[model samples]
Target: MPKYPAREPLVLLPCRLPASLVARFAERAREQGVTLSDVLRAHLTVDEAKPLGKAVPRKRAGLAKVSGADPKLLRQLVGMGNNLNQIAKLANIASKTAQPMAMVELLITLKGIEKSLEKLSES
Candidate 1:
């Protein structure tokens, strides 16, 4: 992957969206409970990825809505990420002080994290 030399410049755009679109946009923006700019960036980024001639269909054609966001599962994912880091430390010790079987448990933990990530992506 090519690395960017600098952060992308931000420009404030003032524009209007359709009524139905505004509703969908508002719903997605609310899900993050963050700044409106963040949600707009996410949606518009998809547009940036597409070919210029192939615009997203109007009235739910190109619009993407957020769904199936499990807060509890999100928390679990965060905790699991932290747990994996801690396990790395233990695995370091285990490699010297304990048997190779100890690393198997770490691999299982990693697999579980991967599965959780996949589930989140699917949602």
Candidate 2:
């Protein structure tokens, strides 16, 4: 008996697709009892006249209009990262020196960092 099924070698074609279109393809595949890849292959294999499956509607404009990140927010993230590193160093030293108060201070600093992150995400 063969350990693996015989099949052609396949390559992955990664792509970004809209949620609605992906849902439609998934529904079609379910209805026909086939994988999404099978549905895509059928659609791609066309004759001279037309392709398989109904044509999807044209995508809307401004769908990929993403603005650049704010410089201020980037700086804030960097500062927060530095604060975390400092806290980690302090935590190690406090543990070695048996300082409970230093550990408490580190915990407070971590809470502040969490709050700052929450506020940043909200904006």
Candidate 3:
């Protein structure tokens, strides 16, 4: 009986490409004296350790400008937001360390913020 060496399993990756692109790839492979599969594999191979390039910024939809809004109310809302953020950070830290947070105070602050937003919208 003859024994054969084990071979790694191969997977079939079926892909559809335009005829023009396929022809270009074939021509490049012939020029380089390599198979079309080799050319495609070389192009598809990525270096896992290499960091990615900077991302391109996408155009975003512009927000509508709020006309005739009270500047003082906006400032107050901004201050409230800052306070809420601080409380949330503390609450998160406490929860992670198995400590209790002032849940009632947080709820009340949230409600106040909601009411302020409604008032701003009405004006």
Candidate 4:
């Protein structure tokens, strides 16, 4: 077998997910020719926030309605794409400290923050 970079140890988490969802993920993993662990690892390795899509011009009235959200917050959210990259790098480091669980929590918290920002932008 060809050698590859040594992967850091992972702690198998017992997630209380719906059986159907679990089975779906398992099937997807199989279709991708990877183990479930590989699928999760790929997810965990994402280091950047991706754009929702191409920005579309809004009507003046619609823009006014969305402007109710704080301008600074909107700017931060618009610019937060790079921030997620940094967070992922930190998560990679945190993986080595025997506190990957904490790192995962941090990643989830950041995702929630990003989602909330998107909600505001969509309004």
| TM agreement with the true structure for every prediction | 0.37, 0.44, 0.35, 0.31
Model 3 off-target regions past 4 Å? 1-70
- For each predicted model, how many residue pairs clash, with residues at least 3 apart or on different chains? 0, 0, 0, 0
lDDT of each: 0.73, 0.79, 0.74, 0.72
Instruction: Record all residue pairs in model 1 with backbone atoms less than 3 Å apart, i.e. clashing.
Output: none
* Residue runs of model 4 more than 4 Å from their true location after superposition: 1-74
Model 2, C-alpha of 97: deviation from truth (Å) = 1.1
True lDDT of residue 71, candidate 4? 65
lDDT of 1 by residue, 10-110 (tens): 66789987889878878877887865666666666555676668667666422123445566765676688788889888889888887778889878887
lDDT score of model 3?
0.74
Best by lDDT: 2
Q: Point out the worst 10-residue segment of candidate 1 by lDDT.
A: 60-69
lDDT of 2 by residue, 1-123 (tens): 112245856779898979998899899999999889877666653354364698799876442243366666666777889889999999999999999999999999899889988997897
Between prediction 2 and prediction 3, which has the larger TM-score? Answer: 2
**Candidates sorted by TM-score, best first:** 2, 1, 3, 4
Ranking by lDDT: 2, 3, 1, 4
Candidate 4 C-alpha error for residue 81, in Å: 2.1
The per-residue C-alpha lDDT of model 3 at residue 64 equals 28
